[model samples]
Every structure is written in C-alpha cells, then in structure tokens.
Target: MEYFLGVDGGATSTALALCDREGRVLGIGHGGPSNHILAPGGEERARSAVLTALNGALAGAGLESPAFEAAHFGMTGISRDSEPARAFAAVVAPLLTARIVRIESDASVALAGALACRPGVVVIAGTGSVSLGRDPLGREARAGGWGYLFGDEGSGFALGLGGVRAALHAHDGTGPSTVLETEIPRRFGRSLGEIPLLFYEGRVQRPEIAALASAVTAAAAAADPVAVSLVNTGAEGLAAIAAAVVRRLTWPDGTAAVAPVGGVFRAGSVILAPLKAAIAARAPGAVLVPPRFEPAVGALLLAMQAAGVAHSPERLALLAATWELRSRT
Candidate 1:
C-alpha cells in the first residue's frame, strides 16, 4: 500500500498526482504558475502550489493526510547546478510525510513522462524550448534551454517574436505582411500605435508576448503566409535541436525515437510536420512518437521508478490511455 506523490511544476501551471505501488493513479490536483525563476517569491510559490495540490489529491482520495513513501518534484528555475533546487527540496521535504523528496529539472520529468523512463529524446516547445535525450548508457544531453532572452528558438517566445517582427516589417515596408498587421491590433484592442505605450507601461510580460504563438498558429492554419513561414521556420529549428541530441548520444541502434511535447506541439501538427521531416532527413529511421502522457504523468513515472517499481508494456499503455482520457476531462 505504499503511495507515491509526483509534482510537475511548470512556468504556466502545476500538476500533482498520487499513485500506488501498482501505478494506479489514486487522485490528482492542480494549481497556478510555479516557474520559480520567473515568479517573485518563487520558492514559496512552488512549495505552496505543490503542497496545495498534494493536499487536494489526498482529500479527493478520501484521506486526511495520506502517508507517502516517496515524493518527486520537477520544477522550472531550480537548475541542477544551482542551490535553488536544493533549497526548494528542503522546503518540500519537511512538509511531506514521505521518506524521500527528490527534486529534478522539469525537463527531466518531461522527458521521463514522454518515454516512461526509457532511453530516448524529448523536445519541449512551450513558452520556452529545450531538447533533452537519454542514451542507452543512461547518459543525458540537452540543448537550447536558455530561456527567452538568449535562446528558446522554436518556442512560443520565438513564434511571438516572429509575429511581431513580421508586423513591424510590414509597417516599415521592409517585408510583405498579411492580415496580422490588422489582426494583431484587433486582438489586443488597440492599434500598433498603442503597442509601444503598453509595453513601456509594463502591461505585458515577456511570456505574454510569446503567448501570441497561438495566434500565429491559427493564422498559419488560416493561410497567412507570414504565419506559415514562421511556423515552418520554428519547426525546422526544433528539428535541428533534436538532430543535435541524436548525434551526441550513442544509441544502441543507429536510430532513436523522439517525443514532442508542450503547447506548441499540442496546438497543431503543422509545426511538428516540418520538424518530423527535418529529423527524418537527417536520421532517416528516427521515430517521432506522440507524447503518451503529460509531463506530470512522466513525473509520476519517474517517482515510481525511484521507488523501484518496474513498468511493463501493457501497464505503460494503460497509463497512457488513462492519462489521455483524464486530460480531456
């Protein structure tokens, strides 16, 4: 009857799950933004989000305080090289009744979630972007997770930046722009004339600017050339990241499977299509797997692994199916 708790704390939101020894999910919970790096009082915010979700899950399962055998948390902003990760772990450990509290990079949990702890590569394209791969020898390599400022190429931020660039280019008569010039203004309820003022007034977060990625996707789908080109370029960049990981890792076989996750992938396959093409061009036999579970479930899978629970193919399939169903609800 050993219970395990897993938390996936991301830039935009957080998720918590409780599972048993057999991998049966007992309860689940969710909370607000927990990207420790970006949030003021990030450590406290992360701790509160996780604890609230864990308590909610316990309450859902008809328990006052379920004793957990182990707890694993995957959070953004707490890097492997930094003290923030340790400090956050210490805060969580004392509150948990669990014997162990493990803290890891959110990317690790996302990779684990997609591959079920199996050796493979995962490319995440959310508000930010990163590619991580695990080889058969358990060696892990990562590329392009530098956040919105320096990197995050092929991410939401990238897409939004492209959108703005396209609009500005059109305004300046440097590039052929489309309806976005008008559409962008309509969506934001102001003319391009007002954009500078809004930005100067601190009405926009960097991520909020990147939030335009969704609009770009929709515009591309609706046949906007600028948007389409932006998506295609983004896909190419993501593919390049995946190929680099594949080249660095020593796969038992020449080919490796790559799983794509995050909002960018979930929004539409148009972005992924070019990425898949690029990966195939380089690694002809590489398999691109649709993510079987959200990263939170991957966090749970990692927790289960840490607890020494083995996963069977059938169980993994069941878990994937269950998670997909749960996600839709």
Candidate 2:
C-alpha cells in the first residue's frame, strides 16, 4: 500500500496525519509548538516537533517506519524555497524517504484546505496574520505576513496588544476609561505597570499576549466602546490584507472565496460582521467562506498532488469522512 504523510506545524502545535492512496487516514498524531522562526531552538525545535508527531502517527497506524510516496510539511513562518525553510527541510529530510517532499508556508496549505485547492484567498490570524491567494490561472500573491515584529494587523497578537495598551492608557488617563483596565489585571494577575515587564523579562511571550484577544472580544460583546473600536480597526486591517490579495488575483467570474482561519475568528459576529462588511467594501468580488478542511488535510491534499495523484470526488469524500471520524477522538 502506498502511504502518504501530511503535517501542519504552527506557532502553538504540530499535527501529522498518515493516509494511504485510497484516502483512508490510518492515524493522526500531535506535538507542541514548532514555529521555527518564533519558537526558541529554531530548526531543532521544529524538527523535534515533526518527528514526535510523525512517530505517534506511525505508531497509531500500527506500522514501523516506512517510506511515503509523498510528504508535505505546512509550517508557520516558512516560505517556499527560503533559507529557513531549506534548513528545516534538510533536518527532516533524512528521516523520511519520499518520492516528493514539500515545505511551504502554513497559509499555502490553509488556502488549499479552505478551497480544497480550487483557487481563492486565505487569511490566517493567530499570533500572526497573513493573506495568500491563487488565481484561476495559477498566479499567486500574498500580503501581510511580516511576523510579530513588523505587522500582524488583524491577528490575535494585535488585538491582545491593543487590549494591553488600552488598559495602560486608561490607567494613566491618556485614553477613555474601559473595562480592559480591570479586565487586563484580572486576566494577568498583574497591574498595568507590570505588563511591560512581562515581555521585557521574557516571562511572557507572543502567544501569551495573543491570548488576551479573547478578553478584548469579550469586552466588545459587553459593549465597551474602546474595545469595540479596536475590534473594528483590527477587522479593517484584516480586510485590507485580503483586499491586497484580491486586487492582485483576477477571478474571471468576478468572485472568489476568502476564508478567514484562526483563533481570532472565534469572536463570531463580533469580529466577522465587521470583517465581512469591510471585505465587501474593499473587494466586492470576495466571499467569506469557512474552510472545507483543516490545514493538515490540506497538507495531505498537497502531498497527494505532489505524488502526481488526482484527487477525485470519491477520494475527497473518503478523506473527509475518515478525517472527521479520526478527529472526533
């Protein structure tokens, strides 16, 4: 039986899936944070995460180490053919014997998963944010994936940082009074003054700060004007990212799917309503859609493609069913 492997390595965790040519998923495994760029230990950290997940998946599949027909690793902070990507690829390459191996940005797999590789845009908002799209003609474009240091506009980190700043501003009388002043301390168990020290001292990291986005959205839900304004601003920023990609790609039918993937979207209509409106205004041709499959399955689809395999409807249905069943446990 010809086997395939697909991995989705993100800022928070890594997930790997093993499947066969017939689209039957044998097993799924998971590991910790592996975003090589942001996560300490860099390529070594990422390599450990991938191997841990791969081993778990293989064990679940009841198989010893075996060569795969094709494998794809969709990783955060990785770009096609980039130096970091190449370095990480080299670290893992020796462990797997595959006819084809691909290392690409997590956004690439998210887009493929969101649209089932059909052609559309995907905006991923986690600790970071980026937008990527592919035209029907196979032309591709991307915008806004500069990472935390540059701009992660609509990302969880941005919203969370806004909350922290709002708290600081309120405390110092520089901004309007908002619940975030109390809310921030309640969440972090620290006064506003200590928040900056959390980062400066390395006691907290990007993901920790990004976690505060939920508090901001919760405040928005409670009708805090300041929080509401931040939400809207963040939504507009994300829409702008999507708008940039939409402009670069031509959809002959004058329409395209723009899927928003990640934790920030969990705010539901609180964030989605503004995001949808902003996207509609910026690119009338774009339609916001939920992803058809998660990124690991997207990576699997890409793996199959790299092996020169056609993904028929029957195969997709099989993959969907099996993945759903496996994920339930």
Q: What TM-score does candidate 1 get on C-alpha atoms?
A: 0.92
Q: Candidate 2 — which pairs collide?
A: none
Off by over 4 Å in 1: 37-40
List runs of model 2 lying over 4 Å from the truth.
37-40
Q: Please write out the lDDT profile of model 2 over residues 191-298, one tens digit for every residue.
A: 779989989999988898999999999999999999999999999999999989999999999998999988899889999999999999999999999888888999
Candidate 2 accuracy as TM-score: 0.95
Residue pairs with colliding backbones in model 1 are 113-298
Question: What's the lDDT for candidate 2?
Answer: 0.90
Candidate 1 per-residue lDDT over residues 1-329, each given as its tens digit: 88888888877778888777767777788877777643478767777787788777777666667678878888876666468777786667666788767788888889998888888999999888999999999998998888887888889989977887788789989999777787777776777667757777998666776777887888888989999999998988888888889889998777788999888876667787788888898766578998767788888887777777788776677666655554555
Number of backbone collisions per candidate: 1, 0
lDDT, residue 180, candidate 1 = 77
